[model samples]
Target: MAYYLGIDGGGTKTYALLTDEYGNVLGKGKSGNGNHQINVDIAANSIREATLSALSEAGLQLEDIRHAYLGLAGADREVDYMILHPIIRNIGFTNYTINCDTMIGLRAGTNHPYGISIICGTGTNSAGRNTQGEDYQCGGFSYMYGDFGGGGSLNIEVFRSVIRAWDGREQPTLLTDLLLQLLGYDAVEVMFNDFQDYGKQVPVDAVRLLFEAAAKEDVVAIEILNHQGVELGKSAVAVVNRLGMANDAFDVVLVGSLLTRGDRGWIRGPIEQALLTVAPHASVVTLTTEPVVGALWSAMEEDGLTISEEVHVRMRSFSDFELIK
Candidate 1:
């Protein structure tokens, strides 16, 4: 009769899942902007709103929950813990564990409790959990922290390639034309002027041009993707080496849009090749289940419940449940 609650809070949205001990999803809820680093009050409110909506949909109260697991963005440092602990306490959950959102993404991509998760979305981040239950993370801070190879970073590379081609520093590339078309510029000089003199930023969506150009066999675009893929793979390798998981048979979960969407083969191929150079037994998996379901699985495991095949099946099947919103 016991119920569990799981929450995934990110910069874009907050998602909550309510489920029974048997892993039947009872309710779902969602809200906006749950990264506490952006605004603590707003993040807390988003978490509460989502949790309350899930509870209401399930006709349950907070006190009825056995355990809750929250995977939240910006929960990385101890200082972050200092900020988030009281927020969770004040929300009235008596039994809960909070972890970085990357952990949920890792869990979502694989059923194993320990593995590496690489996120290549707007930004790049890498994290891993070893069989010893130890966790290590790298490259989520910003570009200054050596965290590169995502949409934001790819956008920069695309602009640089176009500029290089324009100045004859690099061979002319299809990306130049694509960039000109995307930004509505007739000349690379005008685009350069707008970017430098007018402080115009490159649109993140422009990163797709890399895939588009690569698909057309543009050497520069393919090289860019290959280089970025190697960088992303190196991040994963760093985690694998740190965790001593090089020989471990485990999953290397790929999370985020860059690795999951578009013509991913250009990047994914290089990444897999790079990973195999070290962790030969590692398998790369794209996350198919909602990350909040991973939070539920974590909650169940924390409560000493065995996650059976039936549980996995039920959770995956119900992952697309309507959000309370």
Candidate 2:
């Protein structure tokens, strides 16, 4: 009756899951903002809280778990490890492993043990594992580090395009109208004043307007989507080439809100086109399962259990578990 635990700590939220050896989910827990880059104490407390909630729900103590896996955002650089390693150790798990959140996102999208994962949510990043178990990552640091294509980037482009159209620097686009409509303003000038002079921040949900304009065949919006997709695809290609997986048949897993929740073809189509240029045999998989399950699977594997079909079936039955509120 071995029990396993999985925790996924991200910039916005932390999710935890507890399961038996057979993959029947026993309990789930969630909490806020677990990225140590923002606040180490908050991240540590979030992870601890989620873990305890799940354990309590399952009526088990931390020592009763055979293994635990934590897939956490901001766990990339050695500096990040210096901060996170002690936090994880202090959680009282005798057997556990920690990895970047992207790895679990990769696992959630495919059954394969090794492949590429590209995440395009509020921000963008890519990571991959080769058959030899070597790992390579690209573009998770931020825009200054050459990472691009996500909701934030999309909104920036939207504003830029609207400004260009207003200044007669580019052809008029429906993005202007979409933006004005979304912000409850009748004119771009008023919205601009609010943003530039009144210190109003761009709403994250405004990225959806780009998709809406593109759906209506707005050239500027479509071009924005294509540019973002191509950039993200280039990141994936870089990971593939680094891992020497260009000729291999593997899954290129797509994760995050932009990739999973938005209009698929506008962005994903260009990404596929760009990726196919290099890795022709690669298949794109949108992660339908919560990444916490992948962390659980990783823990199960670490405990010397194979991820059999029955286990997968049982896990899939709970695939719709919402990690985000």
TM-score of each: 0.96, 0.95
The 0-to-1 C-alpha lDDT of every candidate, in the order given, reads: 0.89, 0.87
The TM-score obtained by model 2 is 0.95
lDDT of 1: 0.89
Question: Tens digits of per-residue lDDT for model 1 on 124-218?
Answer: 88899999989999889988889777898799899999999999899999999999999999999999998899898999999999999998999
RMSD of 2: 1.7
Worst 10 residues of 2 by lDDT: 316-325
The prediction achieving the highest lDDT against the true structure is 1
Model 2 regions lying over 4 Å from their true place: 319-325
